[model samples]
Target: MFTENATLMLYVENVQAEYDFWKTAGFEILSKETIMDYDTFDMKPHADSTLTFKVYDKAFIKQISPEVADFQPSVLFETEEITELHERISGLTDNISPITSTPFVSFNFASPSGIYFAVKEK
Candidate 1:
């Protein structure tokens, strides 16, 4: 059995930069702590779940899991103002793709740390 609280941890080359990116994108900072001498930031895009980032060395990560360096994990978010949010993020990150429609209108963009996520209209 699982509890309502859940967290997704993403190891990044720069934890502060990733935290800043998400904070600027409107994700609320829940807390911050140090783990294994590495800075960790806990944030929440919505109240249901928490997203955490831990600082990691790219070289070490590559040696341990080479695929992780190139891996782009998709995190889907629902937004009421899809166009407005997309336009706002477009000015910040250049990795945003054109809005696409299949089942619904959505677009994907990468954070400053190159973590990709999708935003769909709710």
Candidate 2:
């Protein structure tokens, strides 16, 4: 049986920009390398975090697996300080939605690559 989430594959057009975005949002880089003529990076929330996000350039993925190059999974992250996190990421992009409480205290923020993700209060 599956135990836990270890890594998630993320495909984007630009690796450097996404790298800066995640770094500015408090994510720590695990590793970065040039593979198959494309830049790739592995990042996580912190050192001890169980989950990881492996970033890859879309063009590279297209060369390897054209059919799956456009699949982007929706991610929902949990945080204890929802408001603080939202405030911190506010200046990063204008596509962020303000914290809403219709169903829960949560907000959605988009990465520089235009993939939006949600953060909900835990």
- By lDDT, the best candidate is 2
Residue 38 miss distance in model 2 (angstroms): 0.5
TM-score of 1: 0.78
- Whole-model Cα lDDT of every candidate shown, in order: 0.75, 0.93
Question: What does candidate 2's lDDT look like per residue over 1-122, in tens digits?
Answer: 98776899999999999999999999999999999889999999777788999999999999999999999989999989888899889978888998999798899999989999999999
CA RMSD per model (angstroms): 3.2, 1.3
Prediction 1 global C-alpha lDDT: 0.75
In candidate 1, position 63 carries an lDDT of 67
Model 1, position 51: C-alpha lDDT score: 45
Shift in Å, residue 55, candidate 2? 0.4
Angstrom error at residue 37, model 1: 2.0
TM-score of every model versus the real structure: 0.78, 0.94
lDDT of 1 at 26: 80
